[model samples]
Target: MLKTAAAAATGSALSSLGLRAASASTPRRGGTLRIGLGHGNSTDSYDPATFIGGFMQAFSFARYNCLTEIAADGSLAPELAESWEPSSDAKQWVFNLRKSVEFHNGKTMDAQDVIASINHHRGPESTSAMKPVVDQIAEIRSDGPNRVILTLEHGNADFAYTLSDYHMVIAPAHEETIDWQSGVGTGGYVVDSFDPGIRAALSRHENYWKENAAYFDNVEMLTIADANARISALLSGQLDVIDRIPFATASRVKSLANVKLVEVTGSQHYSFAMNTQFAPFDDNDVRLALKYAIDREKLVQNVLSGHGRVANDHPIGPAYRYEATQLEQRVYDPDRARSLLKKAGHDSLTVELSAADAAFSGAVDAATLFREAAASAGITINVKREPNDGYWSDVWMKKPFSAVFWRGRPTEDWMFSTVYIGKSPWNDTFWENESFARVVNEARTELDEGRRRSLYAEAQALVRDEGGAIIPMFANYLSATNLNVEHPERLAASDDLDGMRLAERWWFKS
Candidate 1:
């Protein structure tokens, strides 16, 4: 017999154990899927340009469809566009939209909708995080009702994969403008009702293009920012599934026969970001001193409860094809940390770092742990607890230093382009390195694997040594669900919770 799914991760071997229930079951449809997520704010919107949190992305995936999407095994699959072709140079590309695809508003989806939805993030007025990812698009023209041609500023083999981005939601276009506020698209569900961060409901789209999808008649997304509360909801049968269960309380799932804990390791990592433009952090020595102070091993063992692996400060994880693992790991050294702090001319440094559990499971506790460890190096971190309601808008990027988590991108260049590129909207650190930026642009088109690896290795070194981030551990995407919530084997590892597309792919057992 073929090996099936197994529960309880035995170290790193638990890669997408939830996707395989060990025993296969045919999908049964027609029930509301109540999902509880760890974070969401009143700031959530239907506008694709403003979707920052995974909760919003989760809801978006239910109500909207992308041109392309990452399949169960992390390969590209057609969603709206049935097929695509690229020029020999890999710069100019064309997509042929799937026929008979109808929007929730009963409008025909054409190449114009794709062009307008994409341009919403490209223009100068757009402050979206996805701005940098699409900045390379020099132009987009419609060849006809069914075809759209995209011309890039440079050659990129990953151009098609980039279309699978959650931000690339295709909306119904009326003239040159698309009504993003309506939440109408060609997804598997239709927006039944929405209240920003509170809760939203979606009904199955009867005309959904994919027959296997829309299995659940209705789906509901709830914002349960507290970790314990999210797990409690699942245990109480109030929720069918919950994402990002606190690592410490993960064992609670094992005792419940109907509730199962799932773990998938990929590029998901929790990090603390510092504004490089801010005082003290502006000094490279100060950044290095802080990076040296964190005990990554203890973080995985103590804070994460052995649910994750130590990270090397770069966003790249072991899952990515070009992820660099040859570099020496950064170890915890208080004496070395103090030496660097003194070198930076700060004998006893005091700083404020805002934190909340909403940023990630155990984030507040993680900061408290860091505070205790950093005190040994004569560094003072004032951990200010922020409210979950407005943490994303008020505290996150606005604060000089804060704790946050990143579900790493599918590709190295995409990760660098989003957060490390100069003048990019999502450059949380406000860090701009000339050499790293140059390498990011060149490596996108570099077909040679050896040459690409060398470039990425150098970039990783720069981030590890000079960048304003403290990456302690790359986390396993730990979740818990009632047995009634069924999913397929070999789920997408592009990001946590099946790239936040669980609403469409997962169905009720009944």
Candidate 2:
């Protein structure tokens, strides 16, 4: 007998949990901050030119300063640069650097430092995630000691916003080495010591330009790979702050008196990506059928404990303007799914579902939920869970079929280029659509907001209709902090950790 829809959706094999609530009191100052980082993926690099993930982002926060910083409201604000103005044609951007700003190594910040940093990312063999943004620049030259000029290939209204990217942070030009251990930046703090993938210690920079910044005298960031271990550390008072708390444990943590949970609706989506160039998923009907078979709401509630939001047909969230609201929501229907599979000449379909143990907050439990849901729809899903070591290189980026965790990007163009674009470095799905490509390229070049929005809307529609990616839910970026520390009222919207956690501003009240 086929499993009933309600029974299939509500199947439970795991215990439930909750998030810790915030205490009612003001913050005090002066204490050594110990933060538990979720995990340190090998993707962590100090080159700024090629860094990815929260580890690098967290490290960069104290190591470098950008010309312009993105405000909490998404506006571009001056950081290292005092101010900036665009030329009449909108092609050239002239920035006035802050003269009093000095690097941690006692070197004064100048336009030459900005030029060198930008050029380093633009050069070959660079690993900077901001490379794409700098690729549009025709030239970056120092106009004077305190002035820098940027000539873009075309007029881009978002050029200033691009400068606000964490990876675009300026570095010292005279540094003999790129070790990053020397702590030669103009940021709020300076790196005291760094033991890769283990621990990183930082101290407040005495010469920080921003007033009352770097409130904590010392910060020790520990890389804790296991969710339970991190949670234990937080609850036991071993950690002052912890990030990426598991959904299952959120409620339990919230119940505690000392912990304060901060839930920011992330731009990220956790989904199973099928290779369109490969066998079974090559057919659109098979892909759609698979998507229809999985009970996503159940996974969100049961596995993720309803801490996440459901993705509207596409991965891009409501925070972006181009999301398609008209597309039909992909609900689970085992009957329809089975019918499609049988029509495609497979009465019983078997597929491999690969996942990484430490990829998501509750990934192991989430995969089991998927297994049960697929089984109810007459599909045999063989689960393969890999360890944290080399999982990205061996299972995710290299494998043809896999379940991957993706942190949501800020812009629609960034999401398209990174994941769906043909031959992209991180394009694991390997979907190649000529029309989709055309739409994205056009959207990138279109300066008019209305025209670009329309183009992106069309592209999102195409991805939902033709793409093989099954976006289950939009995961929430969870951070738990001690009530004794003063955090920013608003956090960065992007899941990228660099700007999201204002560690520099956090002060421990006594």
Candidate 3:
């Protein structure tokens, strides 16, 4: 049956699960919340269409608000939209807006703003990463100044969760377009200054609608791309918290008197994405050869410091509802890799693998470890260490094979649609299977839970055997914060720093 929009998470329920470590003191307001992030590019922009990496995701949540939110306990919560109801078919949805919500510039928000903001990601000329998501909408119209309606091409039980994506931030309407360049929105903080990929400063919104939130008076976000520098900034008292803590040094940081380690296991995973359109990778045998060549257990132990688990050559992980736990775990087999490489018309293969630590905490080291393991299978991997400054823009999808990481989506359909679909902009591997694509679309609208599970399991099998992505390990979100900082009992596992809403969701103890 189709899932209802009912929220299953509550304060008492989260406390019972012990999701968050409780603090002795209550949350107090009025202090600067400083943060250092490991992911940021010099090419980062204010356009929501281009927001990628950890730094930009966190920045979006601070200065912009989406229509819906995935709460700390993994439940849907209303943001700008107060309430919503579907038209029984789950295709047409009507969202009632919150009354008198003001933008950062003091303009009252209405249905027109929501409509224009959503439509910006649509249309044929768009290059937004979320175009595939919004393209599912058949039509979007306003019922009145306070209500907006969206009619999807197919019935989707997880449509509300899609809008909670960081790319769907609402902005004031300007004719047919939104003023995304100004960084203006109806969020808890107002953008004071922004230098692309360098630093950003924001002040608390004076007339913020959520009176109980946004405890910080100011937020200073730094793009500390180096992992060591990011940790140093937090430990030296130059920053309050940091994301992407190096797992190799986590224990040492935890031993510090003033620092605390925060780790949450989620759907985040690391992959070696090979462009299927590129040479050698186009063969299915070649892809299978690479998949069997890596030792996932070593990666989990050495690279991750045993903070994660081995992953099949698919994106779905343990955090998702329909995770294929029954699927056989792929193990390292040099003889099988050699047989597959020979079947692909190659006695020995040589490939260049681009990698940088910006992709994850120990990505460069992970690639080196993979190179050592693949050598036994007659695979010579040239690990090219790319620069962190513009790695995502230059090396990620542009290179034939490169290191990558995905903060996996909340739902099965959402994950497959965003990255696995044929026409998706973020389909990093550029691998497409007509049958796999068809199964995913069918699973989206299937109302029967048993039937949907069967379809998703099939989809996982197809990707595991034929996909161009070599997913090896699912890493936990490891971060550190000062003891003076206080947050809710549970942090959002969807992404680091409480789904990148740390500036608003966290506070100072004093």
Alpha-carbon lDDT, every model: 0.82, 0.71, 0.87
- Candidate 2 regions off by >4 Å? 1-29, 87-91, 174-183, 338-348, 496-498
TM-score of each: 0.94, 0.87, 0.96
Clashing pairs in 1: 5-22
Residue-level lDDT of model 3, residues 191-275, one tens digit each, is 8998877899999998999987888999999988787888888878999999888889988888989998998888899999999
Could you tell me which 10 consecutive residues in candidate 3 have the lowest summed lDDT? 9-18
lDDT of 2 by residue, 1-510 (tens): 011211121112000111122432244445688988876765565667666667667777766788876554434567888878876545788889999788888888888888887787775555455665576789878878999999988765446656666677788875532434355788877888877778888888878888856777788888898878888898888988888887888898788898877776656688888888887988877777788788889888976799787764467775454566666777888888888888777887888877876667766677777778878779888888877777766787566567778776556776776678775656778888999988987786675657877888889888887886888888877778777655655555555332444566566765
Ranking by lDDT: 3, 1, 2
Q: Could you arrange the candidates by TM-score from highest to lowest? A: 3, 1, 2
Q: Which candidate leads the pack in lDDT? A: 3
The predicted structure with the larger TM-score, 1 or 2, is 1
Clashes of 3: 1
The residue-by-residue lDDT of candidate 1 on 1-510, one tens digit each, is 000110111112324332455754677778999999877778778888898787888888888889987776655667898888877667888889987789988888888899999998888888878888888999999998999999999977677777778888999886667899788989999988988778999999988888887688899999887778888888889999898878888776667787988777778888999999989999999998888888888889887899889998998877676667798988989999999999999898998889987788788888888888899999988899988767778887899999888887767888888888878876778898998888877887665658877888888888888888889899888888898887876666766677788878877765
Q: Cα deviation in Å at residue 180, candidate 1?
A: 1.4
RMSD of each: 4.4, 8.4, 2.1
